[model samples]
Structure formats: structure tokens, C-alpha cells
Target chain A: MGREDKAMVKKAEAATGADNRPFLFRRHDAGTIREAYRKMLLIRAFEEGAENAYMRGLVHGTMHLSIGQEASAVGVGLALRDDDQITSTHRGHGHSIAKGAEVKRMFAEFFGKETGYCRGRGGSMHIADVSKGNLGANGIVGGGIPIAVGAALSARRLGNGKVVVCFFGDGANNEGAFHEALNMAAIWKLPVVFVCENNGYGMSTSQARATASATIAERAGAYAMPGRTIDGNDLSAVAEATEDAVSRARNGEGPSLIELKTYRWRGHSKSDRNRYRTKEEIDHWMTENDPVKRIEADLVAFGILDEAGLDAVRASVAEEIEAGIAFAKESPSPDPADLERFVYTEGA
Target chain B: MDQPVRELSYAEAIREAMAIALERDERVVVMGEDIGVYGGAFQVTGDLIERFGPDRIIDTPISELGGAGIAVGAAVTGLRPIFEFQFSDFATLAMEQIVNQAAKMRFMLGGSVSVPVVMRFPAGSGTGAAAQHSQSLEAWFGHVPGLKVVQPTTPEDAKGLLLAALEDPDPVMIFEHKLLYKTRGPVPEGAYTTPIGKAEIRRKGRDVTVVATGVMVSRALEAANELAAEGIEVEVIDLRTVRPIDTPAIVESVIRTHRLCIVHEAVKTLGIGAEISARIAESEAFDYLDAPIVRLGGAETPIPYNPDLEKAAVPQVPGIVAALRDLATGRR
Candidate 1:
């Protein structure tokens, strides 16, 4: 191995926490880790800006933020092929950004402008980039799971060898679509990876109150597929598990169920009064298990980035997020005459 | 020298349409419970599995919501998936995928993509399958905006409409009458499409127009034949597609006949017939009507398991004849 690789491995090994689990940040080189860190921070900043926009009455309807679940989103995107497809849930901004959605267009969508990804029709919950293989963010709970299976079926039938990653929540695991999709993927041996981001709450209902299973991953056994639960806050762990699952799907082993144990830092939506959970609990996850800070510590321990470098990264990302909002503010609104469009294919 | 036409059953015609579509396009696939080896609940997909193999003719587990969602997903992404429900009544289990996802995906996404999905439901009451196995819910699908609901009565229209539905860019629901599957008619030899959104005049007369759908089309024609013997001419209009309810054709017919009688196997309250009656009354045909528009529909009750009750629940030839005679004779 190269000297830099050896040094990173040594530093990653030495960067283990008091819990004694080997920090495997060495899975990616320092450069890639740095890039992943930037992407996660971009998601965090963009979500914060969106929340502000909603507060300022600039956004329509409501927006579901993934402020605390950045690692799970970015890590899954890192494991996927550039041309690979994904079906996301309502809480899907991070997935869209990580899958390469243009922040300006996303902001335009939230602003309900014509230049948005869906031409302003689908706001926060329904934003999609077919070109990037982000099928769309579904409003219905567990709605996108079967869609991912169908996309996987398309890949298998078309001989594209592309894997489809399906992102849902712990509550979605209880949905019948989840069970049916997993069974179909298992029997058909379709290349799909089902990622359940267990954010510990299903719209204010605690996971304990809603779910009967100890862990969502255990339910994969019922479908006869491999399942795993990982520390979603740890970027290295999330990436490693997702890479393993993606490779398994590409190798024609059917689907793997992955449960990312994460937490959402914000309320479910703009209307949430935060009555479901305690402030102490949110602070505990935000401080001890923050994905961004964990990666910062690893970068600092490995000597790849210093406090100044981290500050620069945050500043650049913040500038980019502000520029995206500005672009969306200047974009045009859709013509009212076009309101009746898309009911059916125009020419077909 | 001339070619001779051969008679084919409605089920056989539908199977032929699917077979032709599978042969024509590699992207076309059919899925449902027991659709492969068991040839579907009504044997409409017989021999398709052997002909096209399991990959094209998929047999799914009994999960309506999942199967429908998968088909919706597949349709949006470059595949013409024809999903079959074993019975129409079970569609209630899949309303979320059909009504919410498939119906709204294109509009909600601002026309970014088209979902070319076809769903086949074995509808209507005739078999001894009782209430759960029987229903005529075409109106339910017709009420949805993005969905196109078609009910093909004859073998010819069965093959034609199924093929046409496959060609449609949006989701199309095909309500194949369970009782009509065995009925035989002269179907064309090759691929053809009965145009959607157009009504066909089954039998022409000038006194009154009998607008009907699915099994009621044949019942209306039979009623027309009986009324013709009674020296009363009844125009029989077969409404092949219900959503794009051929109002112009119905209006023109009502204007010519000066009377209207609508029939459907679904219940009378707010059924497809009600829409047809409303359209006729709201149009210029209302001024020309010599009698009040009549709606002959199924009784307001679940189809019972008893053969006699089941037969009495929906409109029959006798009922259509009686209704049309009353309208023709101006007896309200």
C-alpha cells in the first residue's frame, strides 16, 4: 500500500472511540472522505435554508427535513453507481442531493417555480430527477418501495446490471408494500437494496409504540434475504454496510434489507410543536452522535484537515446554498394556461 | 377468393390480444395470482405462460397493493405491464396504488413521464362466486381523471379494446365481464384496436336509443330485437369506454331517437348510466326528448350467492326491454 494509505489506516485505527469499535474511515481515501463530508454538510445547509424559507413563507405546503440523517443518505449514494436508480420517501432531500440533484432546481421546486425539477408541480415531497435516477420522493408512506422493485425488475430485464436502492423509514417497514416488495425482489432475484432509515419516530409516534419488531432488519429474514443493522450516525459504518448490500445485489443475490439506526434533529414538519420527544434527547443525538462532527474528528485525527480547512468547507457550502436560494428566487413561475398539462402524455 | 371469419370466445379473444402484444413487444408483461399455470381465475390467460414463459407471464403472490404498485412503477419506467386482478371486488385492496399513485403520478410530476399500465379485472355478477367475487365497479375507475375505464362486451371488442388499452400512454382499466368470457363472436384474425373514447351503435333504430355497457350491451341488443318484434324500433348504443363518455354520440342519438334509455350492471345511484342520463338532459338532446330519460341499472344491493337473486340484481334483457318499451310508449 502507498504511504498515505498506510498512514490513513493507522490513523483510523487510532481514532477509535472509548467504546472500542474500530473506526473504519480508511475504507475511503482521505480525499473521498473529504468529499463525502462536503456532500453531507451541503445537505445539512440546504435543509436548514429550506426550513428558513418555509418559516419566511417562501415555500408552499410543507417540507420534511433530514437534518440528522445525512450520513445514511450520503453513504447510500456513495455506494451506488452513478447511473443507478433510487426511490425515496417524503423525508428525501438528503437522498436527492446525495444522488446529484441540482440544489438550485431543488430550491426552485420548493419555491414553486417553472424551472424546478418537476416544473413547480411537485414541491418538497414529490421532487424527482429522472435523469439522475432519483425516481421521485413519494408522499405516501412506503409508496416508493414497490416502485424500486419495479425499477430493479426493469434493470434485470433490460440487462443493465444496475442496482436500485429503496429508501424508506421504520414506519414504512410495517407497511404491506414493504413486505410485498421484499418478497417480490427476493423471489425474482431482482437487484434491489432496501434501506430503512430508522429515525426512531414515525411522525411523532415512537418506534417502540408503532413497531413490534426489535429491529427492522430482522424482518428481512421472513423474506429469506440478508439483513443488517448499522450505526447510521457513523459515516464509515453506513457506507460499508451499503457497499456490501449494493455489491450483493449487483452479483444477482436479490435484495438486502438495511436498517440505519439514526435520529432526526428537527420536528417531522413545519407544524410540529416538538411535543413527541424531549429536548434532552435531541441534544444527546445532536452532540454525541452528530454525523458531521464525527467525520470532522476523524479528519482532524488523520491530519488530513485542520480547523481552518473545516471552516473553509463550511463557508463554501454555505455560499453555494445561498446562491441556490437566490437562483430559485429569480426563477419564473409556471404559466397558468399550462395548468391542465400532464394529465396524459401530450402527443400520445 | 375471399377469407372466412372464425368465431372466438371473449376469453380466447382477450388471450389472443395479450399473446399478440407479448410477441410484438418485449417490454409487455402480464402478472397476477394463478395467471400462469392456472390460466387466471376465469381462464382468460390460458396457455400464455407456455407460449411466452414465466418471465413475461408472471404469477404473483396474493398481494394486490404490492402487485399494483409494482405495475405502476414498471409502467412509469419503460414497460407495458398488464396487471390482472383475479376478481374486480378485490381492487378495493389496491385503491391506493391505482387511485393515488398511478392516477396522479403524471399530473403531480408535471408530465415528466407517462405510465402505460393496463389493469384487467374480471368484473360483473354471473358466476356463483357470491358477493366478494362479483362486482361491476367501472364507475369507480371512471370517476378518476387520469384513468381510462373500458368495458368490452363482444369477443371482437374484447380483443380490440385490450390491444387499444396497451397502446394507451396512461393507465387503462379493462373491466372484462366474467359472464361474457364464454360468449362467442367473430373476432378479427390479427392485431387491431377498438378506439377508446368512442361509442359504437350496435343496432340502429329511430324511435328510442338504448345506451348500454359491458354485458348490458348484449342485453340491450337483445332487448332491441324483442322490441323490434313489437313494432317499436330501439337504437342500441354500446358504450365501449365510460370515462370519455361519448356525449356527442349519445346526444346525436338522443336527438335522432327523441328518447333515451341507459343501462348498466352497476348500481343505480350515481352510476355510469346516471352520467349518461345527465349528459343527455344537459345537452341539446333534452329539448328534443319526447320522453323522460330512463336509467335501467342494477338494484342497490350486493349480488347474492343465490342464482336467482344474482340474476335479479342486475339489468337483464327483459328489464331493458321493459324499460325501453316504457320510454318508447311515453309511459314514464
Candidate 2:
């Protein structure tokens, strides 16, 4: 191997640390890796912007920010086809943006503007874009699991070779809908991948206290499906694992459960007081296991691009997000005359 | 000229509706527990698996939450899924998906997607299924904004309404009375849709107007016959859909008869009768009523296992006859 390639391997090892999880390039090429990095950066910048908006009272309601779980969010996008379907959780801005939702419309939703995906009726929690294959981002925890199963069933019934990725949090594992959905998906051999973003804490309760199993993926055996847990902060690790699951689903091997072991850099929402975990613990994860920084380090170590290229990606993402916010600000609010228009398919 | 219609049981009519839907649209599928090989708890989906195979006639696990959620998901994603609850009472288990997710998705999502799902519940008290399996929960579903609540009282309506509900672009709750499943009626062959929000007048009398739903419509017809012999003519109107109720029909009937009696198998308090009564009282029907509006509904208690007690709990032929007789005679 060349000196730069050897140096990249060493840097990947250093970044991965003692865990030594293999960084196999399954579906990600250099172009896709660069695109994945750009998407992850966009998600991070978008979340930071959402938080700033929430703080400034520009965002009307609270939102769950996947600030540190960018790799897990963007990795699935990079691994799957553009038309692959997904159902997201309340903490779904990162997933939505990574899955190719228009950032301006998402910002408009937060601003309660008429140009939003739901035309401002569904605020932060219920945003969705059906055309992009995002069934919706659910407000209810584990709500999208069954919906993803149904979407998979639809894809199969329609004879369209589409796979569904169901994104959920650690807390949703205990919900009845989760177990039911998994069992149904398993039995039907539905083309769905259950991607659990186990970010250590489900709101206030730590996973250690809330769950009996050491890892969420261990429960997959009960349903007779293949499952694994990997470092969600490592973009390559997430991509490798998700690529396998997506392939299995597309090949009609039924569903697979993948638990991305990651942490949330921000509080669950704006109201969270950070009383659940200590500042030291939060600081440790933020500095040591930041997903965005981990990928940046990998790109730098490979000598693929220097500081100038990385800075250019960051600057462009920031500019795009800022422009989205401006567009949202300029969008008009919904008219009062159309207040009761969308309650049903036809008027009730 | 009258069209020729075939006589079929209410259950057969429902099966025929599903079979026709499956044949016409490849997007349509039937899903529920024990609905495939077991042929459903009431045999409503018999021989369907043999014809359509297991893919189209899906038998779900005994998980209402999971099955209903899957149906909701499938519906929004462009599949016309007909989900049956073996018993209407089991709907309590699937309320989260039905009420929160399926019903609210369109409104909450600002009309971006439509959940064209049809959930069938074999409702009302008749069999020895007793309390757990014999509750009339149509009022509960009707109270929700996004749901279209309908109860088919005849075989013709059972077929026509089911087919029409499948055509709607929203979630529809179809409550088929368990007792009426065996009752044979003239059902039109081929594709047809019964208008959802219209009422049918089975018998037109000049003395008292009787508005009934589900099996009560049959009971009211029997009561009208008994009252006709006693010189008290009773008009019987079958209210097909409860949510988008035929209020104009009720008002018109009350104006002609000058008396009103609302009958249902659901509990008297806050039941569907209350809504109809309130609508009439708020409209022009109140000025035309010669007597007070009478609500002859089920007693406020759990449905008993004993046949006699179960029969007494709801408004029967005897109860409907008595209520209409009293209203016509001014004996209130």
C-alpha cells in the first residue's frame, strides 16, 4: 500500500480506538463517502440552526435534535437507494435532511409557514415528504415501526423493489408496537430494516436502567432475524452494517435489526435540564466520540482533501442552511379561511 | 321497472363485497386474525384464502395493535387494506393506531397523504360472546373527527356499503351487527356503492317516526307491523351511517309524522341517539314534533351472558313497539 493509504489505515484505527471495528467499504465509494460527509455536515448544521431557532423563539414548538447522531442518520442514506422508504422518530430532522428532504420546507415547517411539508399544521414532530419516500416523521415513539412494515408490504404488493428503513430511538424498543411490528415484518418477510439509534439515553432514563438487554440488537434473535450493534459515530461502520441489512431486505431475506450505539450531544428537547447525566459525561462523549469530527478526521487522514476542501464543505453547508432559514422567514403563514381544510381526505 | 336482485345472507354479502374488491383492484387485500385458513371468527372470510391465496387473504397474529397499524401503513402507501377485528370489542386494543395514527394522519399532516383504510368490526350484543365481545362501540368511533362510521343493517347494505367504503379516500369504520349476519336480504349483483350519508325509509307511516340503526332497524320494522295492527302507524327510517348521519331525512320524516323515536343498541347516555336527538332539536324538526323525542337505547350496563338478559339490555321489537305506541297515544 502507498504511504498515504497506510497513514489512512493508521488514522482510522486511531479514530476507532481500542474497539477495532472493521471499516469495510461496502457500498460507499470515494464520491459517495465525500457525499456522505457533506450530508452529515449538512445535518449537523441544520440541527444547530434548529436549536438556535428554538432558542430565539423563532421555532414555535419543541424539536428533538440528532446533533451527535449524524453518522447514523447520514450513513443509512449513503447505504440505501435514493428511492428507499424511511419512517423517522420525533428526533428526525437529521434523518429527514439526510434522506433528501428540502431544508427550506423543513425550516418553513418549524416557522409554521404555509410552504411546509404539512403546510405548517404538523410542526417539528410530524414533518414528512411522501414523494422522497419518507412516509413521515412520527411524534409517537415507535409509531413509525409498523408504518414502515406496511410501507414494505405495499412495496412488495405493488411489485416495486423498494426497501424500507424504520428509524427509532432506544426508548421505543419497549413499546408494544415495536415488538409487534418486528414480529409481523419477520413473519411476512417484509423488505424493511429496523435501524435503532440507541443513543445511550432515551430522554431522561439511561438505557442501562431502562433496558434489560445489554444491546437492542440482541432481541433480534427472538424474531429469528440477523442483527448487530456497531459504533454509530463511525460513518464507515454504520454504512457497512446498514449496507448489509438493506441488501438482505432487497433480496427478500426479510427484515434485520441494527442498533447503532451512539450518544446525543444535545438534550432530548429544549425543556431538558440535563439532570439525567453529568456535565463531565456529556463533555466526554462530545469531545471523544463526535460523529461529525470522526468522519472529518478519516477524510484528512486519507489525504483525500486538505484543510481548504473541508473548510469549503463546511462554508457551503452553512450558507445553504442560512438561505433555507431566510426562505422560511419570507414564507407566508397559512390563511385563517383554510383553517379546517385538511382534517380528512374529504371534509368531515 | 324493478331490477332483479339475488338473496344472500349479510355475512355472504360482506364476503362477496371483499371478493369483488379483490378481483377488481390488485391493490385490495383482506387482513385480520383467523381470517385466512380459520375463515375468521364468524366465517365472514370463508373460502377467500382458497381463491386468493394467503398473500391477499392475510391472517394476522393475535395482535390488534400490530395488525391495525400494518393496515394503516399499507393504506396510506397506496394499498386498499380491509382490516377486520374478529370482534368489535377488540378495537380497544387498536385504538392508538386507529385514533392517533390512522385517523389523524391526514389532518395532522395537513392533507399530504390519505389513509384509505377500511376497518370492519362485528358489533352489537346477540351471541353468548357476552361483555368482552359484544359491545356496540360505534359511538366511540363516531365521536372521532376523521373516521367515517357506518353500520349495515341488511345484506344489500352490507355489500353496497362495504364496497362504497373501499372507494372512499379516508379511514372508514364498518360495524356489521353480529345478529344481522345470518339475516338474508335482496343484494344487488355486480359493483355498486350505497350513498354513505343517506337514510332508507323501510316503511312510511303518518303517526310516529322511528329512526333506528343496525339490528334496531329490523326490530323497528317488526314493531311498525305490530303497531299497524293496533291502528298506530309508525314510520321506520334505517340510519346507515352514524357519523355523517342522514339528519335531513330524519327532519323530513319528523315533519311528516309529527312524532320521533330514536332506537339503537348502544347505551342510552351519550349514545348515537343523543346526537341525532340534539340535531333534530336544533333543527326544524323540534317545532313539528307533536310529542317529546323518545330515545329507546340499550340499558347502561355490561351485556350479560344470559340470552334473556342480553335481549332485554338492548331495544328489542317489544321495546320499540311500546315506545312508538306511547309516543303516538300521548301517554308520556
TM-score, one value per model: 0.95, 0.95
lDDT of 2 at A146: 88
TM-score of 1: 0.95
Q: What would the per-residue lDDT of candidate 1 be over residues A73-126, giving only the tens digit for each residue?
A: 998888988889999999999999999998999999999999899899889999
TM-score between candidate 2 chain A and the true chain A = 0.93
Error of 2 at B74 (Å): 1.1
Q: What DockQ would candidate 1 receive versus the native complex? A: 0.75
How much is B127 displaced in model 2, in angstroms? 0.7
lDDT at A326, model 2: 98
> In candidate 1, which residue ranges exceed 4 Å CA deviation?
A1-25, A29-31, B1-4
Query: Candidate 1, which CAPRI tier?
Result: medium
Residue A253 in model 2: lDDT = 92
Task: Give the TM-score (0 to 1) of chain B in model 2.
Answer: 0.98
